[model samples]
Target chain A: MSSTILLQSIGFGITTAAVVAIGAMGFTLQLGVTNLLNLSFGNVMTIGAFASLIAEHWHLGLAATIIAAPLAGALVTFVLARTLFALFARRQGGAFDLLMVTLATGLIIQYTIDALAHLQVFQFSFPSGSTLNIGPFVFTVLSLSLVGVAALVLAALLAVLHLTRIGKALRALSVDPKLARACGVPMRRMINLTWIISGALAGLAGLVYVTNSLTVDASAGLDFLVLVIAAAILGGAGSPVGAVVAALVVGIASEVVAAVGGSYYSQAAGLGILALVLVLRPASGVWSGPSRDEVTV
Target chain B: MPDQLLRVTGATAGYRGVPVVREVDIAVGASEIALVVGPNGAGKSTFVKAVIGELPLMSGRIEFNGKDVSGWGEERRAAGGIGYVPQTRDVFPTLSVIDNLEVGGFRLSPKECKQAIAQMFERFPALERLRHRKARQLSGGERKMLAIARALMADPKVLILDEPTAGLAPRIAHEVLEDLVVGLAKLGRGILLIEQRVTLASAVASHVTVLVDGRVSYAARGDEFRAVPDVSALFFGSGEAAERSSWSAARGPA
Candidate 1:
C-alpha cells in the first residue's frame, strides 16, 4: 500500500476506534461493577440501531431518531438488569454462570430481532456533508462528528467518575459493594444509574456504528461484539480511559492489516491482539481469586 | 447514665436458616464500650453480624437510638447511624485513603463529606501522610486505623467492630484496642467490639459478654468480670454450670 493509502487507512482506523471506545466504555463499566460478563450487550446495540431506524422510518428527523435510540437502549437495559439479571444473581449464581446466562440472553435477543425484521438487512444512511483533510488523514463530516461524539462521551464519563458524589459511590461500590453498603452507599440506586448510563452509551455507539458502516441488521451487533469485548479486555476490563486507548490500537492494527491482507483478516487481527493480551496479562481477563465471586448488583 | 445507643434483646440469628447464635442479650450505652469475647466457634462474630443486620434475626428485637430496627436492611441500619467495620475486606483496597474516607461519608452532603474527611485526616495523622496512596499500600496497622476512621466518617451513634485486631501482632493489637477502640468510646459513641484478645479487651471494656457454643456463657460489668478466677475455664467447660458459678461469684452474697 502507498503511504497516502496507509495514512487514509489509519484515519479510518481512528474513526472505527472512536465507535468501539463508546461501546467498550459502557460494557466495561457494567462488567466491572456488576461482574456480569453481559454477552447480551451487542444485541442491545442492535436494538438501539433498530430503534433509530424505526424512528427515521416514521419520518422523524435525524435529531429525534438519535435521541430516541439511546432512550430505547437505556430503558431496555435497565429493565432487563432489574428483572432477568437480578433474578439470576439472587439465585447465588457465580460469575461464570451469570456469563452463560447473558450469553443465552443475547441469543434470545438476536433471534427476537431476527424474527421481527424477517431476517433482512436494512440500509441506513446519514448525510456526509463534506470531507476534510487533516495532515495526511482524510475524514468526512459525519466521521468527524462521530469522533467528536466519542470525545464528548469520554469527557462526560470522566467528569461523572471523578467530580460527582455518585461517582465516588460508584467507585467504592465497584471496588467493594459490601463495604460500600456498610458505609451507607445505596446499592440499588447506584446500580440503576449504572444501567441507564451504560445503556445510553451502548445506544449511541450503535447509532454511530451504523452511520459509518451504512447498514443495519439483527446480526450487525453480534458481528461487532467480538471487537467490543476485545477492546474492553485489552483495556483491563473496567477502565474507560484504558478502553479508549486499547480500541485505538485494535482499530489501527486491524485496518492496517486489512490494507495489507484483506477485509476478512481484519477481525482476525483484532482477535490476535486479544489473544496476545490474555497470554501476557492473565489476571486482567481471568478471575484468579475468591474475591471475584461477590455480587454487587 | 446516658441513653442506651444500641440494645439487643434476645437476639437469635444464624446462617442458612440454622441458628448460630441463640437468645443473646447485649446493650451499649452512650460513651460505653461493650466487648464480646469468646473462643473459636463461640458465635462472637455471628452475634456481631446479627446486630449489624448482616444475618437475619430468627426471633428478637434490635433497637438503635430507641427505635426497633430488627427488620431494617444493613444499609438502612447503617444510614440510621450504625458504623460497622467487618473482619475482612474492611476497606476498599484500590481506593486512596482520602477516597476511602469519602466513601465512608456517602450519606453526607458534599460540604459535610469534605469536613468529615478533613476531620479523619486530623485524627489519623498516619492516614493523612498516606492520603494519596491506595488502602492496599498501607501497613497492617495503618489499614486497621483507616478502617476505623472510615467507619467513624459517618459520625455514627454506635460503632460495631468485628475482630479489629485479629491478624495483628500482640503489640499492634494492644495499640489498636487501647488507643483506637477505647479512644472512640471516650468520644461518647457506643461501641460494640468483638475481640479474641480477652486480656486486652477486658482491661478496657466497660462491660463484657462471653459466648460459648452459640450462647452467652457470662455477662457482667467490667469490675465483676475482672474478679472471675479463670476465663479459659468459662470458654472450655460446659457453659451453663460454669456460668452459674461465675454468676454467683459475680453477685457475691447480694
Candidate 2:
C-alpha cells in the first residue's frame, strides 16, 4: 500500500479505536468491579441501538434518540444486575459460572432482538455532510464527533474516578469489596450506580458505532463484541485509560492489516494481538487469586 | 453494661448454614481489649466475622454501643461505629497510602476525613514517609500498620482485627500489638482481636476466649487465662472430655 493510503487507513483506525474505546471502558469497569465477564454486553449495545431506532421511528430528533438509547441501556443493565446477576452471585457462583450465565443472557437477548426485528438489516443514516481533510487525514463530521464523544466520556470518567468521593469508594470497592464495606462504603448503591453508568456508556458506544457503520442489525453488536472484549482484556480488565490505549493499538493494527491484507482479516488481526498479549503476559489475565471469591459490582 | 462497646451473645455463625462457632458469647467494654485465640480450624476467625457482619449468625444477638445491631449489614455496622482489619487483603493494594486512609474515612465529612488522615500520618510515621506509595509496595509491617490506621480513620467505637500479626516478624508483631492495637484501646475504643499466638494475646488482652471444635472451650480474664497450668497442652489438646476436665483442673478455682 502507498504511504498516503496507509496514513488514511491509520486515521480511519483512530476513529474505529474511538468507538471501541467507549465500549471497552464500560466493559472494563463492569468487569473490574463486578468480576463478571458479561458476554451479554454486546447484546445490551444492540438494545441501545434499537432504542434509538424506536425513538427515531416515533419522529424523535437526533438528540432525543441519542438520549433515549443510553437511558434504555442503563435501565436494562440495572434491572438485570439487581435481579439475575445478583441472584447468581449470591448463590456462590464462580467466575466461570458467571461467565456462562452472561453467555446465556447474551443468547437470550440476541434471539429476542432477532425475533423482534425479523432478522432484517436496518439502514441507519446520520448526515455527515462533506468529508473534511485535516492535513493528510480525512474524516466525516460524524466520525469526528464520535471521537469527540469518546474524549468527553474519557474525561468524565477520569473526573469521576479520581476527583469525586464516589469514585474513590468505587476504586476501593473494585480492589476489595469486603474492606470497602467495612470502611463504610455503601456497596449496594455503588454497584447499582456502576451498572447504570456502564450501561449508559455501552448505549452511547452503540449509537456511535451504528452512526459510523450506517447500518443496524441484531447481529451488529455481536460482530463488534470481539473487538470490545479484546480491547478490555488487553487493557488490564478494569482500567479505562488502559482500555483506550489498547483500543488504539488494536484499531490501528487491524486497519493497517485491512489496508494490506483485506477487511476480512481485520477482526482476526485484533484477536491475534490479544492472543499474543495473553501469551506474553499471563499474569494480566489472572487478576484475582484462586482463593478470592467473585466480587459482585 | 450500658458502656459495653461490643457484645456478642449466643452467636452461632459460619459458612453457608453450617455453624463453625456455636453459641459463643463475648463482650468488650469501652477502652478494653478482648482476644479470641484458638488452634488451626478452631473457628476464631468465624466468630470475629460474625461480629463484623461478614457471616450471619445462625442464632445470636450482636449489640454495639448498647444497640442491637444483629440484622445490620457490614456497611451499616461500620457507619454505626465498628471498624474491621482483616488478616489478608486488608488494604486497597493499588491505592496510595493516603488514598487508602481516605477510603477508610468514606463515612466521614470531608473536613473530618482530612483531619483523620492527618492523624493516621502522625500515628504511623512510616506511612507518612511512604504516603504516596501504593499499599501493595509496603512491607508486611507497614501494610499491617496501614490496615490498622485505615480502620481507625472511621473513628469507630469498636475495632475488629482478624490475625493482625499473622505473617509479621516477631519483633514487628510485638510492636504492632503494643503500639497500634493496644494503643487504640487506650484511646478508648473497644478492640476484638483474633490471634493465633497465645503469648501475644496474653500480653495485651483484658480477656481471652478460647475455642475448640467451634465452641468456646474456655473463657476467663487474661490474668486468669495465663495462670492456667499446662496452657499449651490445654490449647493443643483435642476438644474432648479429658482435655476439658484437665483444662478446668489447671485453672484451679478460676
Most lDDT-accurate candidate: 1
Global CA lDDT computed for model 1:
0.85
Instruction: Please list the residue runs of candidate 1 whose C-alpha ends up more than 4 Å from where it truly belongs after superposition.
Output: A1-6, A285-290, B242-254
The C-alpha lDDT values of all candidates are 0.85, 0.85
Ten-residue stretch with the least lDDT total in model 2 chain A: A285-294
Model 2 DockQ class: high
Q: Give the TM-score (0 to 1) of chain B in model 1.
A: 0.94
Instruction: List, residue by residue over A1-297, the lDDT tens digit for candidate 2.
Output: 899989999999999999899999999889877878898899888988888888888888878989987898899899888888888888888888888888999899889989988999887767976899998899988889988999999999989998888898898888878889889998888888899999998888888888888889997777788888889988886688989998898888888998999988888987898788888877774254223465684
Judge candidate 1 at residue A248 and give its lDDT: 90
lDDT tens readout by residue for model 2, B192-248: 999988888678998877888888777778777778877776676666532333423
- In model 1, residue pairs whose N, Cα or C atoms come closer than 3 Å (at least 3 residues apart or on different chains), thus clashing, are none
Cα lDDT tens digits, model 1, B19-71, are 99887878888888898988999998788888888788999888899898999
